[model samples]
Target: MIRPATREEYPHLVDIWLRASRQAHPFIDEACWRARADDMALRRLPACEVQVLEAGRRVIGFYAMHDDHLEALFVDPEVQSFGHGSGLMAHAMTGHSSITLWVYSRNVRAVSFYRRLGFSIVDEREDPETGEPESLMAWSR
Candidate 1:
């Protein structure tokens, strides 16, 4: 089940984000993700429309969106590869004619996953915060 995230669930969502971010972005320093956890919980997540994917009573995945831009999509590392990510993506796409997101160019798995979901690479640039090359991808209904 996917639903709007409650304020009480912010910590849990942050945990999922940290774990998944570390796993999927091995090329980046783990410390970077750790340093961003508090901001994710206190600022970033709240700034977006966040949704959580629950399995039974546990949150297994989530996506954060602002307008038509997808800011984040994460699945708990232990529960990944079981279609949770795709499910979250599908849910995020509903009611929007188009969506856009940025992904680290070195994160091949995520790049391929977005491609499979029909997102085309529209731009490429360096992320100033992380100094990492990233791609801008877009999908339209």
Candidate 2:
């Protein structure tokens, strides 16, 4: 079930991020790690703006939205093919005209998932701060 994320859920969110990053980029230095929540507190949106997908007592996925852009959407790798990401994306689009998101150019699975959701590759640019080329993708309502 999807619901607003509580303060108590923050730790779990951080854990999921760290675990996913380890598998996604095993050699990265811990000091260089950055996840969506790094700036979430400064987004100025209500805390409830982000939704958490809870399967019983565990949080399997979550997504944060601001305006027409989806700031973050991640599912635990252990359950990647089970449609949690798609479900979150669909929910984010329900009341917005379009949503923009960035995906790593090398994450083929995620790139394909966004493409299957009708998000087109809009552009690509290097993140000035991180020096990583991010694929900017967007989808219209």
Candidate 3:
């Protein structure tokens, strides 16, 4: 099931974000993700509209959106490659005619996934925080 995330699930969401980040963005230092955990829970996740995918009462994935932009999408490493990410993306797209997101260029898997979902790379630039090349992607009806 997918629903709006409750405050009580922030910790679990952060755990999924951290684990998935580590797996998806191996080029970035793990410490970077660890240091951002608190910010994710306290600031980022709360600042966005977050929806979680639950399985058997446990959160397995989530997506965060701010207006028409998709800020984050993550699935627990243990439960990845099982369509959770696609499910979250589909849910995120339900009420919007268009959506935008930024993704690290080196994360080829993610870029490909978004492309398969109809998001096209509209721009490319460096991520200020990590100095990594990133692509700006968008999808529209």
Candidate 4:
């Protein structure tokens, strides 16, 4: 089930973000993820509108968005390919006519996932933080 993330679940959500980020972004240095984990926990997640996918009592995935821009979407690596991401994405798009996000170009799986969901690549640029290529994608209702 998808629902708004609760403040009490913040730590779990941060752990998921770190784990997913480390697992999916191999091309990037691991230390980078470790460093940002704190920021994601204390800053990003709290600042965004986040929704979580819960399976009974456990949170398996989540997506964070602000306005029409999706800032984060992370699913536990153990639960990938099980439609949790798709579920959260559908929920995220509920009240918005359009949504936009940035994905690392080298994260092929994520790029494909977004593509399959009808989000088209609208631009490409280097991510300043990691100095890696990234693509901007958008889906319009």
Report the candidate with higher TM-score, 1 versus 4.
1
Query: What's the TM-score of every candidate structure?
Result: 0.97, 0.83, 0.98, 0.97
Model 2 clashes, total count = 0
lDDT by residue for model 4 (69-105), tens: 9999999999998888888888888778999999999
The C-alpha stretches of model 1 lying farther than 4 A from their native spots are none
Which wins on lDDT, candidate 2 or candidate 3?
3
User: lDDT at 20 for candidate 4?
Assistant: 93
Sort the predicted structures by TM-score, highest score first: 3, 1, 4, 2
lDDT of 2 at 130: 61
TM-score of 2: 0.83
- Go through the candidates in order and give each one's C-alpha lDDT: 0.93, 0.75, 0.95, 0.92
Clashing pairs in 2: none
Per-residue CA lDDT of model 1 for 13-92, tens digit only, reads: 99989988888888889999999999999999999999999998999889999999999999889988999999999998
lDDT of 3: 0.95
Taking the tens digit of each residue's C-alpha lDDT, what string does model 2 give over 1-141?
888888667667766766676566544455566554454444422443688888978899888777777767878889877888888777778867888988777777778989999999999998765666789999986
RMSD (CA, Å), each prediction: 0.7, 2.7, 0.7, 0.8
Give lDDT tens digits, candidate 3, residues 48-118: 99999999998899999999999999999998898999999999999789999999999999999999999
Q: Compute the lDDT of residue 7 as modeled in candidate 4.
A: 85
Query: Model 3: how far is 50 from its true place, Å?
Result: 0.7
